[model samples]
Target chain A: MTEPTAVIHDIGYRHYDGVRLGRGRATLALGVQSLRGVFGFGRTTRAKIMPLLLMAIMLMPTVVSIGVMALAKQFIMPYPGYAVFMQAVIAVFLAAQSPYLVAPDLRFRVLPLYLSRPLTVTDYVVAKLAALAVALFGLLAVPITIQFVGELLVDLPGPPHTADYLGALGGAVLYAVLLSSVGIALASFTPRRGLGVAVVIAFYMFTAAVSTLFYAVLSSTGRDDVAPWALILNPFFLVDTVQSALFGTAPINDEGYPPGIAACLILLAVIALAVTGVLLRYRKAAS
Target chain B: MTASATPCFATEGLTKRFPRVTALDDLTVAAGTGVTGLVGANGAGKSTLIKILLGLLPPTSGRASVLGLDTATQGLEIRRAVGYMPEHDCLPPDISATEFVVHMAQMSGLPRTAARERAADTLRHVGLDEERYRPMGGYSTGMRQRVKLAQALVHDPRLVFLDEPTNGLDPQGRDDMLALIRRVGTEFGIDVLVTSHLLGELERVCDHVIVIDGGRLLRSSAIREFTRAEQTIAVEVEEGQRRLAERLAALGETVAAQGRLLTVQVSADDPGRTHDAVRDAVCDLGLSLLRLEQRRGRIEDVFKEPVA
Candidate 1:
């Protein structure tokens, strides 16, 4: 007589009978979405122009170098050197795209819907930062992979060549980590997408100009002993010094850059500060 | 409607103080399963209360729980079982509604394939035709609202918090949205806590109503109790309504004029005679009777009649 199942009525409402996932799957989804957003995937044609144009420009040098290798069995441009020559393009790409990923959510106030799910503020920050970094890595790695393939076809295989290729990939990773954390941390400040874009571009231009001016002034004033330190003010230069020390590559900005260990420490410290700033921004936004 | 014994959400001694003012002041309330209405003005802390219950914001002093889990300590668990549709614009302009809703479904932890299927079903349920494939930037206000509702329902949580869902809709759109809210509760068996600043907008949908003003709870009861039949008949005539009121008053009937309409009280012993008296009065005055009906109480009277 106590069969409760017999008394209950079945309504037409469809319930979710399948599995409900937890935080990990949710974070992964957000990360994958953000990454696709950076490349203008699943967006309008108007949204795809800037990223595609910049990506095309970034690969121009790779195309020319690969063509030269076709006529001769020699590698013209090193993998990391491609990043150095194209630092301006990479900076422009980050400037144009980082705000596209973070500004809309804040402008439209979409974080409330996101925070209402099983996701945390920290999870949000991690997913966004990781997505931007991975996007930047792809931007830098695609050319390198093409070159690696070209070298394999041309029999440019040796221990030094393999080591150099690996080191360049490592440098690309460093650039991605440093650039994305700083770019996203800065872009998350404003709610307007236009303001965010302006902020990121202004940040890059200001640092690059000031660092170059300081480097020239220090060297001309006979303070050559301290001129190499001015390069750290710029992100690309900071990354170059670390790559030079760690991978035994040539430094892009200054010949007498700091030692490998000190450069590595500074790189790690900047990344740590930028990531902490990102987490703090989301914490306030969620509240 | 499930016999869970506990209410859907409960808050005790809940108070939230900001720098300039108190958002929620010592509010203690519990809501049962069904369609419940949270009626308050813009600054009455409805949004603040939802945020605290979602575990996104911590109350200054108090404790709250949703679906029997602590909002402070078990926010993830609470959010896993609760859905929220924010009042503001939250959709990206360039993405299609289907794409955005499916992605949001995955963000709620549904598998990719299942997320797409549920997204399609929920979109159809919200009444978006093939237009669901177009970018949301090109959608009308009603279409956007449907997309917002679809995302909230795609995951199919046990409860949903819809803040001002009918805020910017036309009259017909308002009616359609109310019918949809009712269906969400009755047909789907999902508990709903919908809020509105206007008094009577939600009475047709919500089974229960809660009234709060200036961050204070005024009343909470079943909607039927809030709006029951009264012992008064409302009479609206094409002309000479004032003369009809005077004739009814002269006949020992308690009559009051509210603008062009009159409300006549009936004796508990002989209600049919009062109706006959009104009909006779309208005919003798030679005025066309535009309307004659027993008046039902309204939720607005909850604040008006109780204190008066």
Candidate 2:
């Protein structure tokens, strides 16, 4: 006799299984997937090369500053000091490269592949932010370290405090993270990569212009002693403030900190909030 | 024991609405093991359904479950078990197939060593051999399609959704891609949900077929079930001269003459009888029969309306 199971012709048998999984486990799985997309395997070869090229270019200012300090034996340059120079380079690099790294995934529709996997929109945003942060840090770290070595070799006079170096490194990392988060949040608002890049650059330039305007107004009013404290709204200026505070330079403002420490906390909070909002918007748009 | 006893994917009353349009409108479909063809015109919700089933798009209403997991709620779990090849070219230009697929495999939780080994196996399975090491930017459309297919299968998901996998391919590339899709479902035992606007193409490869129009289900059935019904038989003869037609007409074969052939309708239950009668009439009339076969109903036929 033929097997009883072989003769059945029920149509409902074709129905698919309806299994549900835990969100935590799925989130972990997709987070790893997104992280891998950003960091793992051969995908990073281009990412690695681009940053190296950018870092090589960024190193020019640091190398020149070190050379001037070593050979000329003078701190005659009005550009503040080594810490300020390194911070400026980090700021400029973040302003220019952040959009390139984050905007392509949105423009090319690669985000769908990640969304189709076990990853959520927030996980995707975090992965991208992390990638950009790490890349920018890598780019900035190289030149900063080179400058540090140069300073050490030149026996720059100071109390030789380890905390100073650690603090400066921490400040650089914090500034990079904050700027990357802002870049990603801004880029996420538009799908066009050019528009995204333009917006990020414009944001940085606008902040700089406004700070210059405020300083001009203050200087023209015969208030040369008072620095434009409102310049803390610009992240680059904020980093300058933190650098001055750490290096014991003359306070740029009577308050010793422009916008006070409250502004720094607010900037960090605003960056976090902006990231969260963009992530939520992305989730909705993706769905 | 039924062939459909274990469906790889199923959706019930699935719906999706965009800002200006409803991309998917109350769509429901199910597919068992093997390849299922999802055929529809452009903007007919093919991509919408695939996206929903893949957990990329949350349905406006209703539910879709892939590999037995609810797409809306358990989408992450469902995604882990299902692979998807999107229609668009989204691969990074600088990455090679081996690297891309290996990265994807590792993303699916494969250890680094296993991911690399599986990437090679999957790439070879999709016919990307030495070229797997070349950057995807230099790949032809056909080669890119294979790379996308390899990435989908790298993690060994039980079900794979191929959205317009044959789109943008030349005729030969189309044939090769179709053959690969068939093998993915049959030889590899991986369930496949392949979508395309070309109905005639999928009819040849799909075990089951679902047709949608205007974001709604038009028809869903097995490939054979749709085409197995009795239909017109196309008969061609070298020299019938008028006698064969006259004899067949006298014998109550309702024959209609077109340039060099005759079309006769066969009753659903008596197709063989109709064929035998036409053969006998041709033989008796001394006409050399060149061709005689049932005229297969194309998927396009369902789109045409009958006028009263």
Candidate 3:
């Protein structure tokens, strides 16, 4: 038998000599990728339908409100009331897309790939939460900004109106954080994306319906002072209460939204709980 | 960095206990640079040890370290330095290989441009070409395995832990995967800790062999040491093999003769003298020497023998 000769195949596996940005940059990369995922950036065309359709629905009111003001020479919808009017649309958007950001990773068992990187479990959870918050903020802010800009072009509502619009923008940031936190936290537990959507929507519907009924019952019985407390149960109501306090606008519900301090504390408590749940669910490196 | 003075990984009294079963029991093993084979049966704690080394799971007791960093305290640092390819499928179906690998490279701290470039290079290295742009849901098992391996190597980690890389491949596919793994260790100068349950699969590539049974270390040594030739020789003659065996036995060499072959046991202390005696005995008996060679021990022999 002839002796076998050694053969080398040069596949050109080059060593990476570039700088590694380490854990912070890894977390930032994760956050950016997840944010892109929420809108179906690398997904199929069909995957883009829900998020785009929801976004259009959320922005539709602002466009129609601006058109009404242009035709009738008056503000059709108050800037601070945007959250109150667009609550359901925005909630649907969050419910539909928040699961897109997290559930796939869990169901597909891709967390091991992420956890085995330079990233920690805290970085993983924080990056995902921060991504949802940023996406939700953009979703709520862009239309408000467009409306604010449109309002400026058409007519001058004066300095007070400008201040209110600015305040409403700030409150939009809070709304984004609170709403997205709750949506993502609820979606994190359910591994199936479809089931996650149901859980999120049900969470919103159940709390809003129960709280509204309780408020109506309490007000009819003449316990008006305690009726606002029922609004605390609904996340949308929490957004409205905080928006009213921040922009000095009238509350959306009949029972003037919860007292300012109590409302802010309740929103903070909800955000804290949601964030805690998210962190706990992803505490394992590869769950 | 190339394989440094320190070992690739080391564990001391490493034990992991699930609620119902003990996954690993007092596994104390260390491997230096080069391709080391971690051979074990299914459920033999190979995956468990890899997870602990990657800092994806904390050991229930004892201590372990990878690349000179503690698994518990410096997990992030260890992960940054090491890469892991899991035994099971973990690729997401919705994304393309280029997109997925770029995301993973960036998540390993590579800048965007670098991540993209490195991802392309990694894909090519793994033998993926234009098809990389297609979603991985359509990829075959071999292609999927290659994609998984590409992601593990895209970050240019110093060492890699590959578990069952040949788990679902045909004969040709397994051969190609093994060659790729060997090149990763030799050409790239990266240390590797590869696992397989097929005992003979690792024989051709690994420089060191580590055998584990039920999560405990069975044997640890260089591949040569494990498969070295024993103090025995096989003698084949054209004829009179029984007579020749009797002659060798008369010389006090323990002999067992087959039809035309004599199996002679040589003295461990004076093997060369025994060789001369056998040659002299074969010539005196007028038997033509057809073959004379020492018997090489196999890895299966160690399993048959007790720990000594």
Candidate 4:
């Protein structure tokens, strides 16, 4: 028998001498990847089911309103009112998906992998916040844009007003920032995705119910001044107050705009608080 | 600094104390670029030292650096140049290995195309075949380990701190992983600091071994220095062990007798002479020779005293 010859293959490990792109590009990739993850772009069919369904549901009213505008020769749904109309669906999206984005890293202990990279704790938090904000912006802006375009396509009582459309676009930005801060802040605390979903849903429902209930009790009791302040309890109402004050959209709870720029201040404060919650949660997780 | 000039990592009186207990107590050691094994029993602070060196955790008292970057102030730069494969199961269950590794490569600053190509190359290098496309939820422990390893290498790090990489592998998987670790240091040009509780396993792949216990450095030396063979021969007889020991000891040979085994010292001047004497004495005593071989010192011997 012949002795076997020992041969080594030029395989296994290969060194990469390409462009690294450094921390800026790494943070950008994390943000883009996270934004794609929010709507289940790179995920499975089972994962794609929830986000896409919620989107279709969100667009349902826009389709119906466009059909109404075509047949009745009048635009029924205003661009700014589309999100408030589909607020429940938007809330469900946030509750279901914020956990999908944040919980896996904590549950599986993958933060070490990310923190071990060129990314810092603050970098991770900011990227996730930015992703959620951008995603939420898309959720609101798309339907609002379709409504504007649909109004232009149909015969309306008046031509689609560009000023109001721009106002609603401004409202979408406020809603995006506020909702994302709240969504990530709530989801970061619950590591178990199942529990995170429940926590978010419960948090939104509790705050929303409390705000509406307090508004009803206070305004009906002639305590009108204190009633609009209660609306700040709900996240949608909080942003909607800012939207209503700035863009002159129909206020959902308050009779009129809350004082002057007090609504905007309240929103900025609440956003700051929720963002702090997110930062603290991540700091603890990283440590 | 050039990669070859500075050590892979170094510590200066590094100490990390938790609220209740200290994890790394004044560990001061440095290793060159090679497969250096960080070995200790469980809870011996091997993982803690790696974390401090990776700049993920700040040492309570002292300082550390990897590739000349400080662990505290220059953590981001250090992490950019270093890769870490955590000991635990860190893979997200939903994504395929290819997608996960690609994202990780990008997170480590690799460009998109480079990330993809390196992900494939690294996955194949780690022996993940078509299974790289499969979701990691269904992977066995061995495959998951390979995926973890692939992610660490996907960005082509200059050095990698592999924390208990062979934690849950079978015997064959362990051997394959050790061989891959050796190749990672030499063939890939990436220095490695692999940790294990099993001392015997690292003896095969490590160019140097560092032994720590109770958060303190015990010994650090080249592998050859640790495993240098003693001047002794191990003799085993089928029967008449007492007669053989008596004959050898009477012939002025140092013999330590056990049940059926004997260790006879070989003189430095006449090594073959001692072997002949043992063989002839056993034959005269009519004891059948079962085995005769030189005694080689083991890495495990360092722990024998403390363990007993």
| Candidate order by decreasing TM-score | 1, 4, 3, 2
Q: Report the number of the highest-TM-score candidate.
A: 1
Q: Which ten residues in a row have the lowest lDDT in candidate 2 chain B?
A: B299-308
> Tens digits of per-residue lDDT for model 3 on B1-308?
34467899999999999989898999999999999999888888999999999887789898999988999899889888888898989888989999999999999999999999999999998899998999998999999999999999999999999999999999899989999999999988889999998756776678888988788998898886654433568889888887887787788888877556677777767778789989999889898889998654344556776764
The TM-score of candidate 2 is 0.78
In angstroms, give how far residue A20 of model 2 lies from its true place. Answer: 18
TM-score of chain B of each: 0.86, 0.79, 0.77, 0.81
Give the residue spans of candidate 4 off by over 4 A: A1-12, B1-3, B229-300, B303-308
* Model 1, CA-based lDDT: 0.85
Model 3, docking class: medium
- Which residue runs of candidate 1 sit more than 4 Å off their true CA positions? A1-12, A156-160, B1-3, B229-241, B247-300
Off by over 4 Å in 3: A1-11, A156-160, A285-287, B1-4, B228-301
Q: Tell me the DockQ of each model, to 2 decimals.
A: 0.69, 0.22, 0.55, 0.72
lDDT tens digits, residues B233-303, model 1? 88999888878989999998989888877988776678888999998998888999898977644445566
* CA deviation > 4 Å runs, candidate 2: A1-50, A57-83, A146-158, A189-197, A222-227, A242-259, B1-6, B18-20, B230-297, B303-308
Tens-digit per-residue lDDT, B196-306, candidate 2? 987777877889888888888888888876555426788888885477778878888778787887878775676778788898898778888888876655556656633
| Poorest stretch of ten by lDDT in candidate 4 chain B | B299-308
**What are the per-model C-alpha RMSD values against the true structure?**
5.6, 8.3, 7.3, 4.9
Give the alpha carbon lDDT tens digit for every residue of A146-251 in model 4: 8778888885776576777788889889988888888889888978999999998999899989988998999899998898888778777777777877877766
> What 10-residue stretch in candidate 3 chain A is worst by lDDT?
A156-165
